[model samples]
Target: MLLFRLMSALLGYVVILVTGKATERFVNMAASRGIYLWDITRVREGAVLLKVRLGAVKALRHIARRTKCRFHFERRVGFPFLYKRLLRRKALALGVLFFLGALYFLSSFVWFIEVKGTERLTVPEVLGAAAEAGLNRGMPKWRVEPGRVEAALEEKLPLVAWTGVYIKGAKVTIEVAERVVPDAEDNRPSHIIATKAGLVKDVLVLNGHPAVKEGDTVSPGQVLISGEIPPLEEPPKPGEEQKQGEEANKPKKPSRFVHARGIVRARVWYDGYGEAKIAETGRRLTGRSETRVSIKFKGKEIILSGDQNIPYELYETETFVKTIPQWRNLEVPVELVTIKYFEMAEYREELGIEGARSLAGERALAEAAGLVPEEAGIVNRSLEEVQTGHPENIVRVKVTVETIEEIGAESLFKP
Candidate 1:
């Protein structure tokens, strides 16, 4: 049905009203003469309404005269009539053509340039390389060559390992991947010092003299490895008695300094305290909430939805307000306000003395565990309960954690 209507519209069609005693004879004559007519309906005693193709309307006049029937057009439709209307309004047609031409012309130039996947390289640096290759913003898309941009980036920036240039509509995207380079080694004279007070478990000197050994106790800021090496002194021969005067006249050699590097493992201890009450009381959410939205203008509010009053006896309220944006001192006084009410219930828990003690100990241990470094190896843990003179309804626990970890840190000083 849709296809038939589309064909009728494209070829143009007309609705006509036929009247006379021979209206039926006119329809039969038109159909027999290959002039198609459809939707034939009897309107009155001698009048009939129907539709015919635009090309067949001229032939219908001769058929109506031969059958002694007269007819007039009720409505004219389809593209042929629309084309005639356009011919009468030249300015509107010209405006449409100008809009399409402007759109086509503006889309050919790049408007936006975006750089992606650049961490070590700054955006300006990447854009500078691309600009040198004729891929800058506002350049025509046809003139931009992706191969040349990629090659230029790799050549100009030695840190960039890979690059990709793509043009999508009016936006050009340049993706860059930077190479990973190791930092240069420091050769300045330094010492490895203790960052915390602990007992040294092991010490291995890589480029300096050892200051602290195994089973040695060291305090914060104490040197674990010394960067200075003293010159060795040789004893005189057994029978050389006169060499004492020559030795007294000779000058002593100076000590050599170097950059100290080493690992110092030590045993560290951490303590945490926790307390819990036998009876606990708090408020918790019931997961039931109600929301109300309204508009506020000059301190007056108009409710948009939800109830006027809060329904829950005990609840918490959260409010959010949004107002129209202001432009250079022009501001709207109206604001959209949304309020949410969350239902809350009171809760109380009762734990016996033993249960409270266990909970307090667990809390203390968890607190102590958090203080331990990730690289530390746990060696031992212990918990102790504290008691006062009077027996109370609370339990207090203290936890101690021992860990073995590296404690060496570099400390530079003037020689």
Candidate 2:
């Protein structure tokens, strides 16, 4: 049925009203003569309305005259009439053609250039490299060769380890991966200082003289490794007599300086406190929700969905509003509002003294664990309960954590 309508629309068709003594005879004669007619409806004693293809209208005129019936066209439809209208307005056709041509012409050129995966390299630097390779914005896409762009980018920027160039529609994307370059070794005089006050657990010297040994208690900012080395004294010759005046006249050699590097592991202690009540009361959501939608126009609201009255006795409402965007000074006073209702219920939990104390201890330990470094080794943990003379309904727990961790950090200096 749809295909037949589409065909009728494409090849023109007409609706006609027939009036005479023998309107039925006219329709029958037209159908018998292979001129198809449909939607035949009688309006009065002699008038009838029907539809026939445009091409068969001329043949139907002869059949109508033979049947002594007169027919008049009511409406002309389909593509033929549309084409006639378009022919009368030639400017509209030209405008449509011009728009299509302009779109095609503009789409052939690159309009936007985007750079991705860039960290050490700046956007302008990448774009400059692409420009040198003839891949800049506004350049013709046909001339943009991905292989050439990638090779040129890698060659121009030595820091770039890999590059990918892609052109999608009117936009070009340049993705770059930078090479990881190691830092140069520092030979300046420096020292490894303690970052925190702790008891020295162990010390391993790699390139500097050790200042503090194992089992030593060091304060923060204390030097753990010394960068300065005193000059060694040489033994006098066995046959030569040592002169005190000559030794006094000679200037003492200066100490050597170097960039100190080493590890200083120490035992550190952290404390945390937590308290919990034996009886806790709060309101929690029941996970049952309803959404209501409405439209507001000129200070009037019309509900679109959901019930007007809330079903839950205790509930929370969350409202969201959406409105048309304002352009220039023109604003539309219409908005779509959505309200969500979340049902809530009262909840109470009663824990005994022992249970409260256990919960408080766990919470205190968790709090102290956050302060411990990831590489630290746990040595010991202790939990203590605080006591008050007055009676109380809450339990307070204190946690102490002992961890062995490296506390050495480099500090540069000039000697």
Candidate 3:
């Protein structure tokens, strides 16, 4: 019986504390709007007390000019010990929650590391590289210098040719590239060969015998300079020993050096295809004003901005579907803001044979224009034919154009 009475007293104290806090907050909020709380206390039945406030009533009366009772009246008394205990409990709960939240934010980077493009590199090697790059546990991600880290990683592992490091929230993503190995096996004896089937395009014989002269038309794989040597050197016969000795005394012919340059044109076949749909597209505005809030604890930021907004249209032939759930850094939903623009409708049309042919011709011409240099005049354009197919509504057209210009063919050998 005594325990139950004690529990009831504690419960009453908590209620009084919460009600006092709520009333205080409400009065403060109202005071900002020029309203005040007029509190009054009066003695009631012996130990009981009656408290009344007319501040809200007066404010309401001013607004309406005729109010009877806009304010609430309550009577209470004799629970000082219970009120103090409840207030303490509420404060303790609030303090504990605040502390826990702070601790969670401070130590939230205990997750796993994700290494992308690690085919050539082992996971441990990539992790080690990241550590060397200053990306480690408990370290604020933004502090990991991307430029310095990439340079350090490349210096440490020569195999990682190219690298990109991004700290997405807590995940540290590392994209890597392996070093390229050149082919060593020579089908023919290693020689200085013409790179292209051009008129010996400026041959520079570094360490070989010259075979072709300038302006000579050489085929593909043709040796511009030879590394081979004659089996034996011509020597004077038994009677010409003195003559051979005199020749040796003379300076040996300067190493057979040659520099050949020529111009040659070949029928370089090239095919280009480009596809452009009549569908709608939108470009984001750059000068538009945007407000973003970033919550950071220790260099790690929580972005409160959403991705770009694309418009959608109903009652129109074209429709753009866009959906955004939310962006979260650590299970906490970030802010989201979206703006959409509805576009006008577009009518579909069926193309006849001539229309299809004309469209195909236009596409082919556009492709050809891209292939030939802008300065190079497109003299000839021969359209083969326009072939149409069913089910897969497509028009195929082949266009051949002729232009006189220098074109490169070295990228085909690059790895």
For each candidate, how many residue pairs have backbone atoms clashing (under 3 Å)?
0, 0, 2
Model 2, CA-based lDDT: 0.91
Q: What TM-score, computed on C-alpha atoms, does each candidate reach?
A: 0.54, 0.52, 0.33
Top-down TM-score ranking: 1, 2, 3
Can you list the residue pairs that collide in candidate 1?
none
Name the runs in model 1 displaced over 4 angstroms.
1-185, 236-250
Off by over 4 Å in 2: 1-185, 232-250
Per-candidate local distance difference test: 0.92, 0.91, 0.51
Global lDDT of model 3:
0.51
lDDT (tens digit, per residue) of candidate 2 on 272-320: 8888888877788999999999999999999999999998999999999
Q: Once all C-alphas are superposed, what RMSD does model 1 give against the true structure? A: 13.3
Tens digits of lDDT, candidate 1, 176-243: 99998754435677899999989999999998889989999999999999998778887767886666
